[model samples]
Target: MMAMVTMVAFALEGYVNFVGMTLIERSANDKESAAASWCDYERKGTRDKVKDLRRMTGAEIDWNKRPYATIKELNELRNMFAHPKPQKPKVREWEAVGTDAEFRKQLRDYRPEYEERLTWEFCTRAYDDVEAIWQHLLEVAKINPFDALSGGSQGFELLAWVDENGRETRA
Candidate 1:
């Protein structure tokens, strides 16, 4: 579950960087300037990077809404897992149970709030949030989501044609 959450977060980060760089290349006057601009952009926080992309592409994403809000939570969850600190578990008082012949004492260890966040539902939701954000950006950029490298199950394919003259061209 931790792995899924972390991967989803990292994938979202990579996707934003990819989209941001593409936008920079398209808008900048020169390759050198684009490269330098990208260097500065890469240093910004994840939220800032997303905001930059939204501004560049005219995407009106409400930061307080579903998928967007999920992004913030996902980042926090990723950070918690990435830089985990040792924590003392809350141990409950021992309780006696059963008859004297089978008597046993049990103690419960309380889980931390961060640990509680690692649920299967959360992992699935995080994955869905990433897909939603990716699709939204792709729509604003006027790029076909189906042609995207991460586009679902259709996979990716390249085709080329060769004429009788032996010259090859991509279809």
Candidate 2:
């Protein structure tokens, strides 16, 4: 569970930073300012990036399906796991195991908003939300994320992949 949350957090960071950089590069500013500005904004948290993306795309979107809401929920769960305020005696970490009811009861005093256990199902939904936001931002930016790795467009490799067996693969 910790691993999932950690990975999700990092993945969202990388994605949001990439999007920020892409947006800066697309702007009329010179290359140096664009690069520097992207780095500057990239220091912000993932939630901030989500808000930025929403603002950037809000004019085009109908507000029918609010992607940031899901992202915010996922962010809350991530925070709950990452920095749990444990109320139970000597319970040092978030309960990565046990039934939802048991976990809730254990955290009842600590985090009352943890209505559901951070199960694989919850992670799956979070992952889907992340993907949805990624797609939406890519569409709004008119940027094909794959293009960054495909055509030497960015002048160097920006992405790589690893198979289940741990073999490295270029994008």
Off by over 4 Å in 2: 57-66, 83-116, 148-171
Residue 87's lDDT in candidate 2: 45
Candidate 1 clash pair list: none
Backbone collision tally, model 1: 0
* Model 2 collision count: 0
**Among these predicted structures, which one has the highest TM-score?**
1
**Which candidate wins on lDDT?**
1
Global lDDT scores for all candidate models = 0.83, 0.68
Q: Residues 90-135, candidate 1, lDDT per residue (tens digit)?
A: 6656556776544432222346777687788989988998989988
lDDT at 70, model 2: 58
Model 2, 27-60: lDDT tens per residue? 7379788768777687777877756666755535
